[model samples]
Structure formats: structure tokens, C-alpha cells
Target: MMLLIKNAEVYAPEYVGRKDVLVCGEKIECIADEIDRLPVACHILNGKGLKLVPGLIDQHVHVTGGGGEGGFHTRTPELQLSELISSGITTVVGLLGTDGTTRSVENLYAKTAALNEEGVTAYMLTGAYGYPSPTITGAADKDVIFIESVLGMKLAISDHRSPHVTIEELIQIASKIRVAGMLSRKPGILVLHMGDARSGLTPVIEAIERSSVPIRTFRPTHVNRNADLLEAGYEFVGKGGYIDFTCGMEGQPSPGECIVEARRRGLAKELMTVSSDGHGSWSNYAQDGTLLEIGVSKVDSMLQELQKMVKELSVPLEEALLYFTSNVAEAMDIGNRKGHIREGADADMILLDADLNLDTVIAKGQVMMEDKRIKKFGTYEHSK
Candidate 1:
């Protein structure tokens, strides 16, 4: 398939105003000010002064749909393809959060592969909320090194709900992932899941300073969950680490505030990224060892955060879009085919109107949505 999007305000991070993008067979063939003429059988999309961005990549999501806190029946179902496409997410890094017992690594792997097979880009982390993580290969290093769909290891760190490994144990886990990632040529990262834990990232900070491991190996998420956590994240960034702020559920500290606060405190912009923990469970666990309440993550929060940055805070649209798109691609080490809009890259891009509302979404050269209506609905939804 050939697609020509014209008269679009383009930002592949840096601005190329009123440009054109040409996609043919899942690769961007050309990007420029205009392609004056078209070949036979060309599909032309009138950008209509809309903004074209690199497709959003949610690096941390429960693609298999995590839950199970309440009971066996409460385990969230696996995520559908349209749920991601409708939200303008082209690539997702699936993880098992808080329910690795019921949700195995096998299911996470299969779900990721299913999404990829169905024509969306997907990858997963090996570990979950446990100390000794469940892996398909029984070893974290082997999973990252041998498994193509497995990119890194994720653990719930600093949370009371977490297994709470010591600094030495954390370093040991980090070392294995780092070595395996080096051998496998993948990210081999430790994607830490931060909660409302009061102890903060002190353990992570101490380990990085004391160990031989590089700071880049640790990628912390949910920094915006609390003020102190956000502060810890900023300090981590200052020491040349990457931080991920979740586009968490509404009524939390807004993602916009975290971004602005980080900048206000003089943190490097590239050290930050944003993700939607879509379909993952969010719970307030009581001290008495019970889930007090629970909520499911909405896929739309990724787009909502982007809109808030551009419209509410007056942040430059290009700068804000990077967190959800390019920055994430870079963080996961998949920039070549996933993040940017360029030649030889996957055709994962979103078309938005002047107000930053998602108008069209294309994944892997397939138009999954147009004008905010999903061209591809779930299997059961379409059956009806």
C-alpha cells in the first residue's frame, strides 16, 4: 500500500513545517515539503493543516490486561488490538504488574507476539512484581538474550507491595540483565515499577553509585505518582538516568506538572519519557494486606497527557510529543523502526487536528483509524 499525507505540520522531534510524508509497504519512503506528483494508485490523505507526529509508544502497559487483586475472577482480560490503535499507540512494551502469579510470562509473551502478528509492534519485559521473576527460559539473562520479543526486565521496586529486594540483590539482577542485553544487543534494562512507597528510590540511588553497573540500566516509572517520588526521579535524571512518568488515572498529580516541575528544577529533557500503563490495574492496597480499591488504566491517558502539555501548559508541541513517541522509542532501544518518521522506519504515525485531537492513526502502513473512528474494531464488536 502507498500513502501520501500532504500539507501536514510535521515534527519528527525537530520541526519541518507543512511537510509531506510518503509511506509504501510499511516503510516511510520519503519525507519533505511536498511531493508535487503522485504515481498510479496512490492513496492521498489531506492533512488539512493537522499535526503529524511519530506514533505514540507506550513502553509500559499490561497488553495481556493485568488485574487479579480482588480474586481469580477479577483478573483483567487480555487487551484487544483496537484498544491500542484507537488511542494512537503504535508500539507497546507489555509488562505484568502486581499479578505475576496468575498472569504468567508465557501469557505476556504470547500476547505480545499476538499483537505483532496482528500487525502492531509489541515487546515485553521478563520480570514482574516478584523477586525471582518468572521467565519463559527460567533465567532473566537468557530471556533478554535469547527471546526476541523480550527486551528487558521489570521489577516492582520500593513499593510496599513489592518483594523488596536488598541493594545487593538489586545490583545482582541489574548485572545479569546488563550482560545479557549486551550479548543480545537488546536494551537489557531494569524497568523499575515505582509505587507510593515512602522509602523512595534511595536503594536504586545507592546501588548505582556503588556498583559497576551504569545508570542507564535502570529505567524508573510512575515518578509522578507522588511529589517525593518525582523529586527522586529528577535527581536520578541529574545523575544521567532515564525516568518515565505514567499518564496515570485522573485526579493524581498531573503528568504536565511533573514535566514542568522537572524542567523548573533544571533536569535534562531527554532523561524523561511518558507511558500509559494501559489495561494495567491500579489499586490502593491497605496496610492490612488487602486491595482497598482498584481501577483499570485507560489507553486514552497517553493522548490526554499530550493534549494537556500542548494546550493547557503551552509547551511546544514538538517537545511534548517526544515523551510519548520518540523518547520512548529511544529508551527501549527501538528507535530505528518504531520512533521517528523517516525512510526505512515503520509507518507508525498519528494524524491530529489543530487542537491535537487524534484524527487518524496508522500502524505498520495500515490505516487502523480515520477521523477518530476506528477502522478496525475488536473481533466480537465487529461480529455484532
Candidate 2:
């Protein structure tokens, strides 16, 4: 398939001005100010008033569903293809959360493959919030080295629900992943689910300081859950570590607010990324740790927060886009193909109206959504 988008304002996550973008099959073919000659059977999209940017890459999502804090019945549902397409997410990384037993790494891997078969690009992390990390091949390092879709591992810290992993234990885990990542040429990162505990990022700080493991090996998320954690995230960034801010968490500053605040504090902008813990459970707990209520987070919050950043907070469109696009791809080591709109990159792009509303979504040169309507649906979704 060939797609030509003409006369659109392009951001490439850095303002490229008005240009025409060409896509051949699954990769971008060319980008120019004008191309008068058209390919045979090519589809031309009039992008006169639209803004074209790389499709968003969500680095932290519970693609197979998360939660189970309340009980088995409270587990959230798996992500649907339409949900991702409508939100302009062409690439995503799936991972498990609290329930590693009930939710096997095998299921997570299958769902990751399913998302790829359905349309959008998908990758996954092995393990959950537990210490002895769960894996499809009986080892976390093997999962990264052998499994094609497994990118890294997920673990929790500074939370009551966490297994209270010690610094030595954390370093060991990072070491294994680091070596395995080197072997597989993947990030092999340990994505830490930051909690609101008083310890904040102390353990992660000590782990990096005391070990030979690089600071980039640890990707702490939910840094915006509270002021203290966010401050700690700034410190982590100062130490050459990357931090992720979660969108759609109640009582937390929106990812947009967090990014603006990070900039205000003069933190490293390239080291910060944002994600929507999509399809993951969001629960309220009593002071005594009783589960008060539970609800699922929306995937669209990623796009919504970006819109708010540009339209409401006065952030430049290119600057607001970095957290969702290039920054995330770079953090996960998929920058060469996934995040940019340059020629030879994957043709995963989204077109936005003047208001920054999602208008069209193209993944790997295939139109998934256009004019704010879904053109492609998951295999089972069409029946519904």
C-alpha cells in the first residue's frame, strides 16, 4: 500500500514545517515539500489543515489487563485494538502488574503478539511486581534474550503491595537483565513501578550509586503520583537516569503538568517520558489498606494530556509531543524505527486537526483510523 499525505504541517517531534510525506508499504518512503509525480494506485490524503506527527508510543501499559487487588472479579479487561487506534497509539509496550500468579507471562506474550497481528506494534516485559520474576521460559533473562517480543522486566518498589526487594536483590536483577540486553541488543531494563511510600526513590538511587549497572537500566514510573516522588524523579534525572510519568492517576498531577513542572525545574527534557497505564486497574484504598473501590484507566488519557499541554498549558506542540513519541522510543531503545517520521522509519503517524484532536492514525503504512473514525477493527471487534 502507498499513502501520500500532502500539505500538512509536520512535527517529526521537531517542527519540520509543511511537507508531503510518502509511505510505501510498512515504511516511510520519502518526505518533501512537494511531489507532483504520484505512484500507481497511490492514495493521496489532503492534509491541508492538519498537523502530522509520529504516532504516540506508550511504554508502560497493562495490555492484558491489571489489578486483582480487590479480588479475581476486579481484574480489568484486555486492551482492544480500536481503543489504541482511536487514541493514536501505534506502538505500545505491555507488562504485568500486581498479580503475577493469576496472570502468567505466557498470556502477556500471547496478547502482545495478538496486538501485533491485529494492527498496531506491541512489545512486552517479563515479570510483574514480584521479586523472583515470573517468565515464559522459566527465567527473566531468557525471556529477554529468547522471546522476540519481550523487551525487559517489570518490578515494584517503595509500595506496600511490593515484595520489599532489597538493594542487593535489585542490583542482581539489573545485572542479569543488563547482560541479557547486551546479548539480545534490547534495552533489558527493569521498569520500576514507583509507589507513594516515604522511601520514595531511595532504593533506586542507592542501587545505581552502589553498582556498576548503568542508571538507564532502571526506568521509574508514576513519578507524578506525589510532590515528593516527582522531586525525587528530578534527582534521578540529574543522576543520568530516565523517569516516566503516568497519566490518568487520580490525585496526581497530569503528565502534562508534570512535564511543564519538570521543565520549570530545568530537568533534562530528553530523559522524561509519559505513559497511560492503559487497561490497568486504578483503585482507592482505605487508610488501613482495605480496597475501597476499583476502576480501569482509559488509554485515551495519553492523547488527552498531550492536547491539554499544547492547547491549555501553552506548551509548544513539538515539546508536548516529545514525552509521548520520541522520548519514549528512545527510552525503550526503539528510536531508529518507531518514533520518528523521517524517511526509512516505520510509517506510524497520526494526523491532528488544528485543535490537536486526532483525525487519522496510520500504523506501518496502514490506515487504522481516519477522520476520527476507525477504519480497521480487531478480528473480534467487528462482530460487536
Cα-based TM-score, every candidate: 0.96, 0.98
Considering every candidate listed, which one attains the maximal TM-score? 2
Please, what are the lDDT tens digits per residue for candidate 1 over residues 245-330?
88874566777778888888888888799888888878876677677887788888989899999888888988998788888888
Q: How does model 2 fare in lDDT? A: 0.92
Candidate 2 segments exceeding 4 Å error: none
Model 2 residue 374 lDDT score = 95
- The candidate that wins on lDDT is 2
Looking at model 1, report the run of 10 residues with the lowest lDDT sum. Answer: 375-384
Q: What is the C-alpha RMSD of each candidate to the true structure, in Å?
A: 1.5, 1.0
User: How many residue pairs clash per model?
Assistant: 0, 0
Candidate 2, residue 354: lDDT: 89
lDDT score of residue 38 within candidate 2:
76
